[model samples]
Target chain A: MVKLINADEAVSLFKSGQSLMIGGFLSCGTPDMVIDRLVQTALKDFTLIANDTTTPDCNRGKLISAHKIKKAIVTHIGTNPETIAQMNNGEIEVDLVPQGTLAERIRAGGAGLGGILTPVGVGTDAAQNKEIIRIDDRDYLLEKPLKADIALIYATYGDAYGNLAYDGTTRNFNVLMPLAADTTIVEVENFSDTPLDPNQVIVPGIFVDYMIVRNKHG
Target chain B: MDKDKIQEIIARRVAREFHDRDVITLGIGLPTKSIQYIPHDIQVNILSENGIFGVGSYQTEENYDPHIINAGGVGVTIKAGGCFIDSFMSFSMIRGGHIDVTVLGALQVDQEGNLANWCIPGKFTPGMGGAMDLVVGTKKLIIAMEHTAKGAPKILKKCTLPLTVAQKVNMIVTEKGVFEVTPQGLCLREISPYSSLEDIKQTTEADFITDLK
Candidate 1:
């Protein structure tokens, strides 16, 4: 069952040095209310797993610019100059993963697979020192699965039971993060008493643990 | 030629390489501009790493949907029969060798078809997005870039910077010419109307086999 909670209460669940998977791409699907609440917390040394830090004044980038993030595993951070500055200055440890590989690793974690065999980084520096397995004379890099303590996702519509519906591209990572986290919290634009349409529900409430209602789009 | 004309020349030339039913992906820089130059008769599907397939032309401001942008974060329309998916499925199409071709921008392309595009040592790069994946996964890899940057030849004998992938590129298209990466070596295929064989030799640092047949 999913419990409906406020943003402040959701923020209370987080602690320092924890790992989090935040669902967003350039602020489209980010949990703004939860991010706003998390910014007020004194938590530091948190490991963030996301697409990008977004912008310096937006979403996960706010935590990054505030120096709350100790480490970030992301695809790009060009828009967030603060992240680049911090990375260059060694204030934040950045692990840049290919966007596809990052998505598959999270998918693998949720699916309980050992790891995925990919040829994406074969001849690049990304392949250096990584395990290579050959099948039928072709080589692949063994990318490991990834999971986190918590996953913060945004939903356009969610029920009390936590069934989630997303609008347009906002469904980017929100559908997958829940499957890859120990606890999944959603920030939603609409809170409903009745269930969402079965065909419309992209994420089943079973994977979701908590919901924060915004009733407004970010 | 002026820089914009150079880019236009490169874009127009690169657009000729596509076949009618090719499932192609284009990178953000010069390759993205190639779409406008593609022949109107050819029917090809354009895939975006940001979960869009069959990406169409730009949207008007009134029709713009923020949640419906391409990998480059530009608002685009979806072609008929185009479907939306998450990143996981999109990459599956890439890494599973389902994409027919991928066109990308390169910083440097060596004689052996090695690409060094993601970074320049001691400089800040946003990091490799889907360049590595597309190069490794696509059946054909086409590199579209300027002939030179700041008076330095981008086509080189050997890339001085870190490589994105080694010996993966199949074709190279520049403002001045087109080169094919054959098993023997880089072969000069076509020269632009603006340049001759002597001019190409003078500009490019890489040793290419001139098989202009």
Candidate 2:
């Protein structure tokens, strides 16, 4: 059974050298509290699957600027100049997936689907010796699904049963990230005691393993 | 016009569209330039997909943190009382409708207002980035683009390519004019004196008409 905890206790679950599927494309839809909690832990050498690493003072970006992460699978590194600096300096390993491909790969990971083929990143430096699958006699690049040891997710609202409701704009990565990891942690605002309406539940309760109620500290 | 000149035309259009106190997200190219020209007193809070909301082009050198980026993933700085967040948290803000307006770049805008930002035929394509989500999720969408690309009118009667977001554009600002998509078709609200409806039609693929006075 999943345990219910506050932001601090829930985030403590992360450890050094863990593969983390942190949800969000760019900066939207991150589990802020869990990220905040990770800060307190000083966990290092973590592998992150996300869209961007961000800058030092960027709310969630500090993790990268502070050197808390080891590797990342992402689309672009435009915002985190330091991250780019690290990459250019060969201090960081970056696997730049096309944005849509990255999201589809995450979804495939969660759905337990094998890698799919896409035209994204094709004919570019990004398309290295990855498998090229042929569909309808046309060549498409094979992209692999990405799985992680842990998943950190954010939501606008949640019920005690772990149903999630994400607000717009921030809904980028939350929908698929929960299932790609062994353990899924949700940080949410306004936890409700009543069961969430089935019609509105974006992330089902079954995929969630832990719930962290967002508080003032978050 | 050259790319820079075209962008300037788009810049002025976007700067004029700023709503006071609005929380805004600007996409790549001209959409991002709105920040550089806005009146300083507008008090619009800016959000970037890469994760900074309180920012602009004129950030101090000391404040050049790389993680702080705008919707285009370009590095930026934050204003006072601003907080840096994980990219995931930033997406949550967008998914949750926390942003009031989003300015997207358009490769092709169909008559029904669907957008195609990725995969241009015979031309190179870029990542869809966050456009698919922004078009579907943001409360309002404003597209900024050249009136045509390589002399081909991208304002289409219907999307001929894969769609990034379905029927989400509310307003469009191009080098040639400003248009609002309505039930009838593209409504030309503002047109450059040098251009006309027929001129737009020569390049536009959609059925468009001058708005009723």
Candidate 3:
């Protein structure tokens, strides 16, 4: 059973130097309230896993701007000047993974797979130091799975049991992170006692450990 | 050729390559513009790497939802029966080779059909997004760009900048002409009506087989 908790309690799980997988594309589909709470905390040295660190004022970018994130595994960071500045100055470590491979690695983590074989970064700098395996005479890079201490996700609807339903592009990374983390927390805009339609539910309640209702007035 | 006209011609030519029911991914910049020129008769599902499948063209500002956007962060509508997935599933369609064609913008395409478009050295680059995956996973890859950058030939003997993916381009569509990548080298397939073979020779630095059929 997924327990409903307030934002502060949800973010309290975060600690210094813990790896976190946050769900968002830019700012959309992000657990902003949780992020705001995380910002309020003095926690630092976070290793962030996300699609992109958005603009300075945006969700994940706020963390980057605050210098809370020590390392980031992301696909893109061009939109945020702060992240670029930090990366260039050696203030933060940014490992820019190919977007597809990043997704598959997360998926592998969630699915309990050891790793995936992909040809995406072959012959490129992105494949540096990675093992390449040949199956049937074709080379594929072995990308290890990615997991985290906690995963933060956003949803349009969540039931008392934490069955989650996402809306639009907001569903991007939100749906995958929950499966790959030790503790999965979802921030939902709407919550109901009744379960979401089985077909409508993107992430089942079994994967979710905690649910936070998004602050309505904020 | 007029600049806009050249873009239109190149877009229209690329649009012709799209067939009905093809799962296609369009890169940012000029490739995204190609959607407007896509023929009305053929309905291709435009996949956005940001987790959108069967994406439609730009939506009116009045009806736009800020959250509903394409891979480029522009508001867009979805085609009938189209659905949304996460970036993981979106790239699964890409890396799993479920996509048919990917039209990308290129900075330089070498004689061996290699592409270099993501960045220019000494300039801050955002890093590669889904370009590397698309180049390898899609069945066909097309490079859509202007023939020259500030009058410097982009079709080169070898890419001076970093390579996005090696020897993966199947076709190159430029304002001046259309080229097909082959084992021998780039083959000139179609010359733009506005430009001539001499114009191509004057601007193109790479050796291309003049096999105009």
Write down the lDDT of every candidate, Cα atoms only: 0.87, 0.72, 0.87
DockQ-superior candidate, 2 or 3: 3
lDDT of each residue in A1-218, candidate 1, tens digit only: 58988887888899899999999888677888988878888888999999888889999999997889999998888778899899889999988888888898899999999999887778778887889999999888899999999999988899978899876667777889999999999998888899999898889999999898894422
Off by over 4 Å in 1: A216-218
Q: Report iRMS (Å) of candidate 2.
A: 8.5
**lDDT per residue, candidate 2, B97-195, as tens digits?**
787888888778887888877655334333355655455447788999888888998889887776766667888888888899888777888887657
**Backbone N/Cα/C clashes per model:** 0, 44, 0
TM-score, one value per model: 0.96, 0.58, 0.96
Residues A1-218, candidate 2: write the lDDT tens digits. 33588777776778899998876645555677777657767688888887666555664476777678778787666666777666666666866665656777887898879987765444334467988777898557798898999888777788878788764445566667888999998877668888777887878888888887777435
Q: Model 2, clash count?
A: 44
Interface RMSD for model 3 amounts to 1.2
Q: What is the lDDT of residue A204 in candidate 1?
A: 92
Chain B vs. true chain B: TM-score per candidate: 0.97, 0.89, 0.96
Model 3, B113-135: lDDT tens digits are 88887667657668787888888
A76-99 in candidate 3: lDDT tens per residue?
Answer: 888999998998889899998888
